[model samples]
Target: MADHVRTVLGPVAPDALGRTSIHEHLLTLLDHVAYTPVETPEGRELGEQPVSLATRWYVRQQWVGVRDNLRLDSEAVATAEVARFRAAGGGAIADPTTDGIARDPAALARISRATGVHVVMGAGYYVHRSHPEWLEAASEEEIAERIVRDLQEGAAGTPVRAGFIGEVGCSWPMTDRERKSLRAAGRAQRATGAPLMVHPGRHPDAPAEIVRELDAVGADLSRTTIAHTERTLPSPAAIVELARTGVRPSIDCFGLETAYYPLAPFVRMPNDGGRLAIVEALLDAGLGERTLIAQDICQKHRLTAYGGHGYDHLIRDIPVMLEAAGRGDAVEQLLVANPAAWLAW
Candidate 1:
C-alpha cells in the first residue's frame, strides 16, 4: 500500500489518489447555518439582523441564494455527489472545513466509505470570525499541540486523523488572531509532516504576507499551498511571484465565475477562461510543477445537486480546454502528479 497519503478510509499509496481535488468543501456547516446576503459586490446593507424570529425566518426564505443555502447536512446527498466525482474518474478530495465551519470527521469517514473516494480532512482553526471562544484564550503552543493530536490521533474526538494542516483562514492585512493560528499551524505542520493549505484574504498581497509569516515560524515553503489565487490574486505575475517562493499556488476555483461576495474593488472574480490565462503565465514562468488546481466548492450553487458545475468540472472540462489552447501537456502535472506529491506524507 502507498504510504504517501492517509485517507479517512485509511492510508493509501500516492498513485491510488488519481485526479484529486486539492481544495474543496464536501461539507460545510457555518455554526448551524448562518450567512448575510450582500445586495451587491459592495455589501450596501451591512447591518445586524432583526431580533424577531419571524423576521429571521422571512430573511432565510427570501434570501435563498444568500442565506441558509450552505447547509450540506444530508449524508445521502453528499454520498451521491461523491459518486458523481467517482463516475468522472475522481479518486480523492481534500476537505478543509476545520473547527470554525463545523467539520464532521465522522460524516467524512462515512462518505469516504460509502463512495470509495479518498477523503483527506484538515486540522486547524479557521478565520477570526469562525474561531471558538476558547481559542482566543489558548496559547499558540496549546493550539499547535491540539493540531498535532488531531493529525496523529483523530479529530473531534473521533478516530479519523487529518491528513493536512489547512485551509487556515487569513484575510487581507492578517489579524493578530489569524497570525497566531498561522504560527500554530506552521508548527503543527513541522511536527506532523502534513502539507499546509491556506485561504488568503481576497487580496493580491495576502499570499505574500502569509509566506512571510510562515517563513518567520520556520515552515517549509515548498509544502505550503496558497489557495484561491483565481479569486484573490488576478494578476498572473503576482501568482508567479508566489510560486517563485517555492510555495504552490492553487488556482482552485475552476468553475466559479461570480462577483457575489463584496470583493469587487479588491478582486474582480475570474471565470475558468481567465484562470487559464493565469495558468499559462505560471507555465511560462517555469513554475508548472509548483501549481495546483481545484473548485473550492463551499457554497450550494457550486454543487451538482444545485445545478452548478460539480467537482468533476475541471477534470472533465479542463482537458478539452487545455488541448484547445495548445497546453495539453500541463494537464498531468496539475491534476495528478502535483497533488500526489503535495498531499503525500
Candidate 2:
C-alpha cells in the first residue's frame, strides 16, 4: 500500500493535503520557556499585562517576555482561527506541538473535526528546558519508542496519531538530552516512514549541526526539515547552503515581523517582505522544492482574535506579494505542492 499522511483524524493521501501551512501550533503553553523575568518594574509590567489592543504592539515587539502573549491555548479561538484559514483556502495544517510544549491531541482532533482541516500532530520532545524532568533519564530507545507509539498508535492517550516525528527541539550548544531526542526522532522516522521536522537553535550554525546529528543516525535527509530557516540562518545564501544538504529549509514564521526577537535578541527576525525575498531567492537558487513556509503562529498576539494576521496570512497575503514579484507560479508550489510532498510519509 502507498504511504499516507497520518493526521489527527486518520490517514490522508499526500495529494489530499491542500494549501498546507507547513508549521503551526494551534495550542501552545510556552510560558515555561518564554515567561519574562519580573525583576525590573518594566519586566513586571510586561509580565502582568494581558494581550490586548493596547498591549499588542509592544507585545509584538517584546514577544518572549510577556506571559500572556506566549500562550495560545483556547480551543474555541483555535477553531475560529482555523475556520478562517479554511475559508481563505487553507486545506491542512502541520502542528508540531509535541512534548515540552502543550500538545493537546484531543483538542487538535476537535479542531480538525470542527473546521474540516487536516491536523498533523508532532511527536518527540521540545527544548531541554521544556522537557519533562523524567525525560532526562530516558534512553534514546525509550524516546524513539514513545515517538513510534504516537505515530503508529495514538498520542497523549487519545486516538489522534502523530503525522511526523518532530519539531524536535535542539538548541545552540546542544544539550545531551537534545542530541538524544534528535537521534530518537530519526529512529522514529525510520521506523514509521514519517517525515522529520526540527526546531534548531538560535545560532546560525545550529541547522548544520542538527543535520549532522540526524545524518549520523541514517535519517532520510531529503525527508527532514530544518525549520525556522529565516530566523536561524543569516541570509538566503546560508539557507541555500543548508538546503544543499538535502534537508528542506522552512521559513516557518511568515506573519511575524519584528526586529527585536526576545528569544534570541541578537538574531534579527525577518519581516514578511524579507521573508518573501528569501522565498524568491530560494526559487532562484533552484531549491524551490526544498522550501517550506508557514506562520508558525504560537503566540496569542499573532492570532486574528488578538489583532494579528491569524492562520491565513500565507494564503491571504503571500500569493499577492509573490505574484507582484512576477513569481506567480511559485504560489501554488509554496503553499500547496511543496508542503504536500514534504508532508507525505
lDDT for 278 in candidate 1 is: 91
Write the residue-wise lDDT of candidate 2 on 153-226 in tens digits. 99878887998988899988899999998898998877777899999999988988988888888789999999
Q: List, residue by residue over 1-345, the lDDT tens digit for candidate 1.
A: 344797887788899899888988888865233365556643324223322333433332333324435565667878888889989989899999898787999999999988888999999987888887888889999999999998889988899999999989886678888999999999888777789998898677788889888898888889999988877776888889889998999999888765443334446767789889999999999899998989887755567766668888878898789889999998888888999999998
Which candidate number has the best TM-score?
Answer: 2
Error of 1 at 98 (Å): 0.3
**Residue 128, candidate 2: how far off, in angstroms?**
0.5
TM-score of 2: 0.98
By summed lDDT, the worst window of 10 consecutive residues in model 1 runs over: 42-51
TM-score of 1: 0.90
- lDDT of every model, 2 decimals: 0.81, 0.89
Clash count list over all predictions: 2, 0
lDDT score, candidate 2, position 195: 90
